[model samples]
Target: MRTNTTPTRKQAPVINFACPSNQSGLTALIARLSAAVAEVEKWAPVEDRLSLEFSKTADKPKVKGGVTKAQQLISDGEPVLDLPATDWFFHTRDAIEEGRAKALAEAAAEDRAAIEQRYVALLADWDAQEAAYNSKKPRGLAHAKRMVSKAHRAWSAAEAAIVDYEPQTLAEAHELLAYAGLDGKRVFFTPGETDLKTIMRNAAAAIALHGLN
Candidate 1:
């Protein structure tokens, strides 16, 4: 006669894993970097257009108006209208244009410089944080919880396979459950084995009964 005996599996040892808590900090840093890059892109187009406009009309005066000798006389309450209409155009055009071009160029240059500086700093901080996050191993209760969740998912999959097998007898079902990683030792059911709505109605009835009591 031949006999078959079930083999006992040895218990596996637990491993300690490390979890980094700076994930949120790293996420914030990445968000900052994205915002900084967006700011640079936003400013680039306006600055470029302004710079190009100034460059194209470099010879032309940019600023249009300033205090003229005639305007000054008018401001001084002199009868300027009595004199030939002041040649306002010839006196101020060149000076105003030149002043405006210079001002536009200077402002664009300053803005571009500031954007570059901020972008570089954000890039550096983001890179450092990302590197730190990558280097650390996941640890602690959070890691344990993740592992437990994974195991639960695996068990659920096993249960699904067992259910699909459609064993006719309780023994056959228990055997399939055992094959699918369940020990077939314990069973748990919600009170009254009812659906959610029924459970809720029962809870309301219990509350009302307690009130009457």
Candidate 2:
């Protein structure tokens, strides 16, 4: 019998994805999250099969000299001994591979689930806030403007919630929040603030005139 005792080789790094520069902050984050989830889903099935194979075969006893008792009995009546079997080596390798695959698959699955939960919750919260804004009615033009301003504020806050996640997802999330003007700046129009472009432009002119005087 011939036995090969070489150690298992380590897997090489593969670059499966890279965020594009032209994508909006939110788009980039979403793309990355989607890729991560897809990878986990792709490998989960292989991991399951490997784990099952290991469980069914790892504990079975290995025969000495690579021969089962029945094979040894059959060999006794023959002129020469039959070739030794190599099941032991193959079984050992399978056991090791199964363990590795199971661990990697489980870890990836956890990360995928976390990102999905956070992403869904963020979308739901945004929809709920927008719906609340839409349901309000205004009695006059001035009130209507105020309502719009309030809604903008609510929308900004809702968008902020979309970027909340664990450290693993923070790099993309922070970029998205910064793009949405939620990174500690009061970007959205507040109640009583004049945010209409025409109004603001006229106000700027009035301020200049007053300064000259």
Candidate 3:
């Protein structure tokens, strides 16, 4: 019976996400928050598994050749004799689970307050940013169309008649917003339900870009 004396460890799970260049501080913070969410997902499993390191080495000193009970048993049964395969599985599992519940309760108690703070801050920041974006964002369809470009009469005419011109994607919307000389790309993560969408669609976006050429 071969046994390894290597100790237990916890390796963090990899998270894959990156905020693009020239993004606002909010986007950078949110990218980090995504990683934190991943860590939260691994938290319970790491607690359940890596916490076993305490069971493995808490009582033992840092001395070489420390004989575990299984090692002692193997030594007692020379030449691999009486090396039983079946190992201990606790029969009184409910009590063990009760202890688990108590342990997890303690851990959650320590973390829950900070988690709440994080949530509150995130919402507050989002509101602040949305307010700022809306403050500068042009109001009304005609204003936005005029912002896009008044250089071409026919292009302006094409855009002037449209009712809904919001772009389909955030990037295009931002580009359109830039043409309108307004700030669009910085704060928003998803498509907004505003007049901004008017310049985002094909007809309006094409009109904004090519402009009746």
Candidate 4:
């Protein structure tokens, strides 16, 4: 019972989301923060090695001469008594946490920049579509039908949501037209309406056409 037909329409991925774009939302925020953590870990080999070896049991582990390793490493030689390994470890950990905060801030700013570019480009493209459709000088019916789709794209960008309407019947089409500021009474012309039938075939034209205007 399979049919050899292919659908001819596709919705943009951004249309599926309610945010400003596919890349801005709570999900994207978490993703960016998670990526920052991975980036930090990927590059902090020295810190990773130190954490694995140190962080453990009872009292602070002391190196030669009653001094901890953190003090010796920070000074590169003699122990810094005032800055013991315990204190130095906490200081270094806090600095790393600060770096993670900065990374997230920078990433959020980048997403804002990219989202602005996407919105600007979307509005420009829709403006061009409206112009192209208007340039065709279509009949009243054709104009209404084409503008329904074109107007929805403009509204979608403004509201950051899909507002498309695909009518399956004449009543539905008229509803869409009304919502889009189009009057449906002016459209006419259907097949075999060349003579007197043309003057009295409003409903025929409605059902015959793609149900617009």
Q: When superposed on Cα atoms, how far off is each prediction in RMSD?
A: 26.5, 27.5, 24.3, 27.4
TM-score: the better of candidates 2 and 4: 2
> What is the TM-score of each predicted model, taking all chains together?
0.23, 0.23, 0.18, 0.17
Q: Candidates sorted by TM-score, descending order?
A: 2, 1, 3, 4
**Cα lDDT tens digits for candidate 4, 56-121:** 311332211123545333356766546445322212333444534554566676575665554454
What residue runs in model 2 are displaced by over 4 Å at the alpha carbon?
1-16, 60-162, 165-213
* CA-lDDT, candidates in order: 0.37, 0.39, 0.38, 0.36
* TM-score attained by model 3: 0.18
Candidate 4 versus the native: TM-score?
A: 0.17
The 10-residue segment with the lowest total lDDT in model 4: 1-10
For model 3, the superposed segments whose C-alpha errors exceed 4 Å read: 1-23, 53-213
Per-residue alpha-carbon lDDT of candidate 2 for residues 1-213, written as tens digits (9 for 90 to 100)? 001211122212222445577864446544554443444444455455554654454343221212333343255557755555443322333444453455456667657666555445444544554455444422243443444444333333322222232122344434443443333442331212222233234334544554445
lDDT of 3 by residue, 83-191 (tens): 4343432223343345345545676677756655644544454455445544543224334333222212222222222212344445544554564343454422222
| lDDT minimum window of 10 residues, candidate 2 | 1-10
- Predicted model with the maximum TM-score: 2
Looking at model 1, report the run of 10 residues with the lowest lDDT sum: 1-10
Which candidate, 1 or 4, has the higher lDDT? 1
Clashing pairs in 3: 165-197, 165-198, 165-199, 166-197, 166-198, 166-199, 166-200, 166-201, 167-200, 167-201
| Alpha-carbon deviation at 198 in model 1, angstroms | 19
